[model samples]
Target: MRPLLLLPLLITTASAADAVITYDEHIKPIFREHCLKCHGEDEQKADLNLANFTAVLKGGSGDKAVVAGRASTSLLFKAITAEDDAERMPPKKAAIPAPQIELIRQWIQGGLRESSASKSLVAARDTSFKAATALNFDGPPPMPESLPAFTPPQLKRPLPVIAMAASPRAPLIAVAGHEHVRLLDATTQQEIGALPFPEGQPNVIRFSRDGRVLMVAGGKPVQSGSVVLFEVKSGKRLTSVGDETDAVISADLSPDQKLIALGGSGKIVKVYGTDDGKLRHKLTKHTDWITALAFSPDGKSLASADRAGGIHLWDGTSGGILLTLAEHKAAVRALAWRSDSHMLASGGEDGLLIWWDTTDGWPAITNTNAHPPVRPAGYYGKLPNGVLALAFGPQGELLSAGRDKQVRLWAADGRALKSFASETALPLQTSITFDGKGLFAGDAAGAVRFWTTAN
Candidate 1:
């Protein structure tokens, strides 16, 4: 009888220790899911802001939520445990489960220990059951004890992740920050390694059609534009070319891996020999800064889009513009060629998704806008803002990330299938790609979020 009584106390102590909560690891996530949608940085319903600890402690129109050591009288506890539907928090579900509520109660009663950063990334994601634990393989990769020497710290004015690329042959995605590219395992959304290009923040990170090599292009403004080639698996830089005098924003390695083409603020598109870094051809037709580029899967055609709402389809062998696409009313920012090598997709600041038919004789733009529903636009307008990134799925489906922070799936005929709206407020998703089984989005906040492809 004595041992049995002590066993209950021991179990209670251990569970209490495990349940000790923190701001980022526990409370922040809870508030994010249930409260922040209504009282976050954007809206602040009832003048309550719970997005951060300071705001939560300061409370809202009601009063302070926590009183240091009392959980029974805390307004937060009362609202969440209220029996009346109108007075209940979250106002949707019956309420947070008793286990989580008990954890919150224990957390307030025991002095709100803010757990260290070592556990924040995985805290709220703990699995519930043994079987579920086995399936919970989603998270950031194990971070090193310290960042690599070449990797720059996330600066005060963080560099915008302007470019991201996904390999067609594997589950790897590359995201560009200031002066380096982070290669992530698309399935797990973990940082696998860093590919270093220290001259400047990379404007573009593109893998070859075979996915064996990655080409990076960018440099300090007006000084020199550099392009570097690195072996994908080993991170061994193979070649470097520093000749251009402006930022190189658009670049790609041809399917044959024999040539690399890039264009930038210099306004001249140039192709270089992959083996010797020698200039192969220079095509100067556009009058504005180049923004996006892609090579057809068959390696026959190269498409380059510019800031003037113009897309030039060039013959890879002759460097001549094959057909000029002028459907966008603003700058074209993203371009993707279907896997079949027959159709092209382009998106721009005008909130239009135009498909181009690429046949033997006639190549003209299709008249369709694969815009997702207007709900994500909030009170702004009928359509989401511009499309900043685009990708094609394995079976010719389309995926695009918009300025409205919605990622939408589309059929090949320009029909919207489903849309995933990001939960974070004011997330300007700058880049997006598909990795066969999942979709990866990189936003201006330097975070890459991955989600399972919704069928």
Candidate 2:
């Protein structure tokens, strides 16, 4: 009887055992049960995919999850083996049992073989990859490739506008003002809607990634802080979150519309879950008030700027501080993350725009004084008079607006592209928004304007 029991146990551990643990049969189940619900099929957490062998190798968020025969060095294994409870994988739950853990180790050691169950997941991942790869634009034929003289547009309004954002799927644009928020048609320069707020002036207005929600932040005069969300088409109020007494200086949404990051109140960067308006994480690391927050395109990390001239990188899920950058000389006000690269673009009050390569953990790209440097008669100086807002166009162009009353476009590499100036004399403080087809500008007198390339 003892010999028969030994034979069965030996057969179970043998390489020819019927229950072969391949990437499809054993490893995928491990991920589904212990990993994927957060970082797998439903969502790509940490920019990683465990749904298939290919996606596991392609990696996500920051680094590769698997390294072929090196499970001990793989980020996925490292996360799962984290000694610190907060750093452990499937975070917020107990560690996986040892037998299940050994299966992952054996799978990694066996070259991570894939089975039929992984085919569907691999096909889905490949489709997404191909779609992203096939996107190519000629960029308006390079505008004849010459040093065209800068010509500022003539302004029709007299007051200043602060910030703006355009809807991705429509001609609608939202503009921020002293005491009102206005929506406009990007093609006709027509005011579509004007909503007034008596509680406080708005500091910024941005459209959600899906274009279904618009978020407005500002406090009324004598009242300091608040943030509001409204339906884009009907102008109906959706919900308001945070203290009305704490001024929300800047805000942005995650790429998937699952989170909102609010910059306000004593260096706090509050991240809220969009589904229930619940506080997900409150990042407290900046020494001064936060001025800007931008999530990376993959949605695993967040970049934040502050009045203390600091920029920070945070892990989106755990809210852990990953990096702190201090290259700006003054308050950092504007920040934009490139959609396909590990680079961050920032503008500061010191009249400079710099791009940092997050991969190298240093300032790898720089564009000093991004605004037009010369001031002609009735022309604001080159740099946005004050870098009040920054955004990325559909084709990845950088657009920025300044207190000096101008909006300038820049190539992804930080080269100057174009500049638009209103012909008016009111010291513009303009807000600019863009759709793939055109650019929209809003000014202080509650006027919105549009510009586009002639077809």
Candidate 3:
């Protein structure tokens, strides 16, 4: 009898034992004994019903209980295996058996199957973002034809414009406002249209590679969060991705528009599928909240920076860690990739603007004190010199704003071309127009100011 028990335990831990797990055959009995009382047919907790296979797959309360192939991110698995007594399932009850937890994990990772003959429901995806060999602009760039009518919220005061983006191929700019986004004609500096952001304030605005789609990422702080997409030509709401516990501070879409990566209060950088909204990869290497994220225009690499000033460049295709850039000593505020994707730029709160050559992960140019503090005599302590935002121009020039309340333009060789000073507001965001003739900067005072190379 002792040998028989030991034999089964050994098989469970052996690498050769890759047994198929199904909900009907293996999971039903375990849930009936431990989870049915609270989450089964009789009573549903948090609106989650785990009584049947379909119900478990459907999820509840606007969240999925079982994410097909990700056991670690599945709500059902997290609940049953939670370390906290309060969050753990079967409230106040003894922990579920280790074997049972293992079974559940196998069920999810092997794909949530209904029975022995049912098909595996694992979300198999190609994570790579293949860039186009060359950008082909056949005609004029896409613009909104007819947008849905939306009543703009009457604001008592202008909300701080924290996020903004310029189209890669058009004279348009999207500026984030309070629960809304304003589209401006870069040439005229006039409002062309507006789009509603029912989700909280838009923390990050991005245009797709072709400038045909708009991606806005944000949500109510300390509450719900998600990424919203819209068709640029029609102002049609496309889809929303991610359901985070807090606001997403930074996010970007791949060059092919196949993947969306976002981060916020959580240290993890979650990449999701644009079509199915499934969690594809969780880059958990960051030690602090992710403050900046961007993918290379060539769609070969991804860069994620954190509040701790840690910057990591990853393989854009497989999400593999490529390089850990250790330079900034404070929060990273912005990340920009050149059109050719050979160079990457990062601005941080430490007042350093570094240009990195992605080929070998070396700093090609480091601008220490990129934003020199303008302090009068007797100014004490640390005068603010943090680089707030960065943008790349078409000709490989760079635009940067900083705590110095000045927006400066830099040449491809890191030479200071010109500086535009904003006397009233501190610039927080900056973007360059497609043709490299115009630039836009959003400030702390909720103003989206426009300028050109001639300035």
Q: Which candidate is the best by lDDT?
A: 3
User: Tens digits of per-residue lDDT for model 1 on 266-354?
Assistant: 77789888778888888788878888888887789998988988888898877887887755667887888777777788888777666
Candidate 2 clash figure, as a count: 23
Clashes of each: 1, 23, 0
lDDT of 3 by residue, 23-119 (tens): 9999999999998888888898788888899999988895999977556568888888778999888798999998999888778867798998988
Runs with alpha carbons beyond 4 Å of true place in candidate 2 = 1-159, 196-198, 221-224, 375-386, 403-405, 425-435, 443-447
Best candidate per TM-score, number?
A: 3
The weakest ten consecutive residues by lDDT in model 3 span 1-10
Off by over 4 Å in 3: 1-134
Q: Candidate 2, residue 99: CA error in Å?
A: 67
Q: Give all TM-scores, in the order shown.
A: 0.62, 0.59, 0.70
Ranking by lDDT: 3, 1, 2
Q: Rank the candidates by TM-score, best first.
A: 3, 1, 2
Stronger candidate by lDDT (2 vs 3): 3
